[model samples]
Target: YSSGPPPLLALRLFCGAGDSENLLLGGARARVSRRPKAMASAHPSQGLPSGMDPSMVDEYASQSKLLQEFVKIPSIGKAWVFTSKDENASRAMVSVSQSDLLANKKRSFLLNTHISKSSSKSVSFQWSPFPVEMSGVSAVVPSPSGKKLLLVRNAEDDDSPTKLEIWGPCQLENEIHVARSVHGSLYADGWFEGISWNQEETLIAYVAEEPPQPKPEFNDSGYKKEGSSQKDFRSWKGQGDIEDSWGETYSNKRIPALFVANISSGEVRALKGIPRSLSAGQVIWAPSSSYSLVFVAWSDDNGFQETPRKLGIKYCYNRPCALYAAADPFKEEADKPSTDSNKGDTAALVKLTADLSSAFFPRFSPDGKYLVFISAKSAVDSGAHNATNSMHKIDWPTDGKLEGSLSVSDVVPTVMSPQDGCFPGMYCSGLLRFPWLSDGRTMILSSAWGSKEVILSINVAR
Candidate 1:
């Protein structure tokens, strides 16, 4: 049991003009206040309506207490199922969260479960005795081998720095604190979040906020000299440029950029060659020896007008985006100072889907033979905010060579209308990181079927 102050139970009472009462229970007092006539008329009764039965208030309180108990039950947030070396056994890690109403925060924890399959085609799960609480953690990612765990704790304020902790089986292995000058908090939101570990697990590539832009500096003399680091109480910085954001939930958030961190040396570097007009997200390590990166880039010119305008992109799948590939920044730096004349072109970003208007959520096959992605071309071509989705795959070069253009093949075409009791269409929100089954050609994903959601096993080879 946790050792701290006992949980606080609060009860608020609002009375009419001439009604008042005092309640004391469990060494705590209830707050009671009177409402004015105008407010009483506008907001109605705080306990019961004018004509409603007073006994109903007691019933409501009883139901509210039941809801509080229900709220205490944690909800599953994420789950990962791993196959064990033993043929019939497996392990699963599930992240669960509960709302702390007293503290106005969310308490998250991880639970471990062991699964075993029997010859009778039955399955059973054995849960651990206690859960491990993850306090103040923004994200937790495990390496491919499950030997290393990465925990991300984002800064809560401007003065604080983001912290990354790497934990081994027994103890904490490494802790890295990133200053604000390097980059802002990493994007934990699933939309722009893309944290991936390479095959070797020595490096990690993810999406985060770009470094803050330079602001206009001024002093008592008016307009401080350029590149001057003079420090004085009179000198202040002004907002240099007012840039438009993706709108809605993205307010005050910086443009999402690509970054890579060397877990061994604790060095982080932003990926180069991406254009300023595009924002990157959902990055993944390409199946190449050089460790190339593939990501989705959204253009800023997504407005209805001719000029560039930043539109709300949270759930609007119609936003024009395309998948692009770029060489690893570290590899580029290592190969610099070479006499190759085509270095510029080789280091530049290459568009993987030049023909499709919308492509995202790129996933490589288990064998790295094909790169499959979801397309919202119907939504982009039409003016709809969302529409039926289609699945497509590109034959990745076996030699890890990227060309100017690659042929795209459609696995699942968008179905506008369906017959009675037939397959409607694919309305997918997102895909699991590893959606493939034992067979390398089949993929399992969830899609919307009318008002209900159902899982489908699609064979990309078809």
Candidate 2:
């Protein structure tokens, strides 16, 4: 192993199936052990290099302590974040490391990485002050082996002064505009609500919306909210006078599409199928990398509009959400044995239409052959669990392990609830890492509840 300052590190392992409570693995099945931190002693007197001064040694020691304060790192593959409901500027970071990178492997959720979203200040790593902004780490995802870090930040758009900025291994200091999406209007633009990084973190998936550019003639393209148009702005009496005023006509497309970008080649493209104009919120990136699957759920009308008329309560019958899977031609690292080998082929396509009434949480199994989603809207399952919600599995085409439904009477609430302090107010907004642990058959699911909130994970082995 190359010895030097750590380029990056993680604190969590992938997911799988099992169960847990105050216990981590399977409620009672999981066990815990403690190991000690490493020691670097060559005898204090023998330490200093020939030319270094004794005073310099003391100075260096003090600096090291300061760096540890801000450069704290978690284990690889098993970290998550949780946040609030309404968009806010507060959040907490939680992580679980498996102990030694190589050794007894004391795996556990040992530390909490909490930070204020608005902490945009100067920081130093060793001898440099790495300037940082606390705008918010919209999403966090661990690479398959937990070797790389993929983080998305909120940035200023090309047109406006605010948008999403993505940073990580591919380009450490530079930020790229991988996706564009709209919210309600100019002022109501949507941030990232859903994100899923392929197990390897080579691919990035997120949900964003871009307000529709209205038609010039009868388009009402730059339609103003209520009477707050250019003509009415003159009459308005206060600030936020333009918060959500710029809206496209109702009939205009407002759905956000699935955006996938190859972090390396600087390639950015919107997923196929979605109307670039419609508003698509909450896009989830599936774990499998061969095929890109993102789910976009939308409303027939303005989803945020609370008014019954705006909600079309009388006319609207139900919610419309669909799953779109785009297969890329990239081959698995294993498939490419030699550098001279040709690139891989495109992934086979499969589209799933999930039942809407239940608000199912669809999760793909570690093998990527099947999908597991909640079947019931809600239930009371005794012993702390209110009910047994339905759990479903779709067979992986090759193994055909898919099952119609699985009973959940035995599943515990703590396993499904907030593992590392993701209370109600702080719901999971996105996943920092997918299931990890077993060689490949099992992994952890890291989910976020809200803003830069706290994300937690539960261990599951299928």
Candidate 3:
């Protein structure tokens, strides 16, 4: 809860810019006070969207005092907030600019009300009721440092597509006002089709679909027909029709190219030389170390040739979105690593892939010694460990082609309901590496059930 000075605060609203497709300035004022209750009616019936009458929103003060004035901008969206602390009260409202976000404009404002008696607490939804507009920001992600907000916005024009923008450390908590961006100055090109943020918030990856192309006849590398085991690969259907090779007939659904960027330096570049599909699983940064990895899975004709009669899903790729890793070397390492073949290249942790059933949510142990992953095995055996563990190391091909050197540790059976891989034990997500652990080999993992993760020892050094 927070309280602010003055018994009055009001702001001005203005008309929308001509560039805005929807040119109407939407404004609002929010307040906290006491008033008589009115007979309630359903919102649509009351001719009020939420059955909330702005009039009944008690104006503890006779008039809405002018507080924060926002003017002639594309009226984005708006929201309201009311707060109470030490029996004192106040209100807040905010509106975001669509033109601002679409154009990569960095405009935002935050207000702080030092509620009396109390100061710190989880900032809940009830604290403020101001409507803020940012719908054009199809996706938003906060930087690992909490100092910047990344926004992916679609082009305002009908024909143009989406782009990427960054809102710097302008938004400060505790009511610090947000700084706005300059119109038309915001942009990172290419149609930003998808996005996923790493846990550290330092690296970012997105998929950009290229223009469509014609498909050619292929009877060579990937497809073969067998009487007993031949099955459809494109669609998971046991027997499905295959379409002809036409550019427009088939959509421009090419495998999405992935790119990683360093938030600290504004450096962005694409990860090349990896076999990936647009619908692949996510790319992530190693939690304990600073490296980017994208994982994808593909099978040879021998692997996916057979399919059961009964089917309920699509393409039969048992494991998709396999994790792949890449970490650009730092300056010092680039300048001074062994060029010898025998000593081995420890400087650049060559990308390593793990061979198992299927894995997701792969994370490195705090000490960067072991990787913990939830790998998928088969359903028939219903066993505790990966049925097939093929570990190997390969010389990374210079052509950007990945050579498998995937490795895996023995699986630890579930503490409860061993049939299921997931355990009912008080140990799960929000896992943290606490400094207080007696042995560095052990780290703490959190269980959302009831308690935070406590130190637990593990035999990692072995």
Candidate 4:
């Protein structure tokens, strides 16, 4: 409205309670009417700018009405499907959001539904009567057993502490407030974000911004001595050193680091042993009794010639990263020191995908026999922003003993150029946390296929 062109009108049809396939097919036969000339003659009372096209005003009004209708329909966000004790019954929790233009924010809520299948292969979804709004919530994650829910309410201001609420089936169980001195906001942004609950559900590991670095304290008397915390009204802090962050959307963001929270004791500990030159994210508890953490680490030397330059990582799959495994900090502290000369190699951080240039979204198979992950080696090697992804698997030791070097097998190789009607390789932006099917060997994933994105059932054993 401020002298710019009208917003592009995007019309989307949503089939709420009907056969969506037939409705979509019927759309092909539907027709749209053209703009009538009479619409150009607008009401005189509605004052408009000189030389402005009257038809544009009418068109804008019409489009605005359609937008209002569309805005009423909330868009689906994250969803989780859980199987119940009864084999025929299953439940699903779907998060949806609608834009509240008046408030200049989004209103989020959860839709509960019951899914059932008949003998005739017919499926039905019984949705709840109303959705429960989740106000002031940044992220919601359900535990593996679906018995507990983790709600993250990131701090809105520097003074406010970030709140982590552990909600049980019937009530709020535990709430922990993390101060800025421990860490900044948790990374809710999809790229570097990784929130994972341990198998026991007693601990959670996630990625968060490191605590604020110390600044140089100064006063009217010039630079103050370091470590002097004397209260002086005239004393001010100076920018100590400027650090390079992942470019683009990561402006003014602190370096990402790993942290684990004990749900029972409400104790949060920042993980150590990772090199300062690397940034960690997408953390998950490894399939081990000790609960070792597996995560993706991006080295600071991501630029050409191995220089310490951080390129824009958002949507840039070419960034160099690799999977790493490190022992749990609490477990390491509790265990006695080993006298074995090889103990250092066993306890230290181990690179899981040292042979690959890029690896992420690590997931362990249901049987805990293999660790599968998607690789962007094609994008990394060719220096492309993105390319066809390849799936790889590592044979995990049954004894939970990680070796220095593990064998990696290629499950799906990159397809350079596919033929007509053939698969155009896997173009997956992200992988689900639990992608395995009932067979444990079959994995369900969504990948881009030409103009459409299609769900694929891949047999990892093949």
Segments of candidate 1 deviating more than 4 angstroms: 1-54, 289-291, 305-307, 338-346
Candidate 1 per-residue lDDT over residues 1-462, each given as its tens digit? 212222221222332333554456677776555565567756533566554444455666777788789889999998888787998999888999998878988899999999999999899999999999999899988887777889999889988988889888899988888898988898988888999998888888989888888898998899987788778898888999888999888897899999888888888888876776898999999987343899999999975432388889989998888999888877777787777755644467889999998999999998998999999989988858899999999999988888557899999999988888999989999988889999988999999998899999999977
Write one digit per residue (lDDT tens) for candidate 2, span 1-462: 223222211111222322421224435444333222233343343566753444466667777766555344545533344334533322333434433433544433423333333346543222113223222354445444434555555445445422334454355633555333333212122322455566555666665445334422212344345533355332423232112211333333234445555666655544544443233444554543444464544333333322222232112222233343444323333455687344333233344444422223456656665554433223212211122233334443453322343222211132345446434321222232334344543434333343343434443334
Tens-digit lDDT string for candidate 4 (174-259)? 99999999999999888889999988999999999999988989888998998886889999888878788898888878999999
The estimated TM-scores of all candidates read 0.86, 0.41, 0.40, 0.86
Candidate 1: how many backbone clashes? Answer: 0
How high a TM-score does candidate 2 get? 0.41
The TM-score of candidate 1 is 0.86
User: What global local distance difference test value does model 1 have?
Assistant: 0.85
Q: List the residue pairs that clash in candidate 4.
A: none
TM-score of 3: 0.40
lDDT of 3 by residue, 1-462 (tens): 123222222111132223322222255434333222353453323563342334534442332221122233445333333344434444444444422334556554432233333356434324334534455555555544435567666446434544556666464222111111111111222121335556656556655443233333223344344332533444232233332211232232333445555555655554544442222334444443334454433221112222222221122223322445654323223344476532223433343544444444444444444555443334212432223221112222334433455445543433434334433333332222121144654434434332343433344435
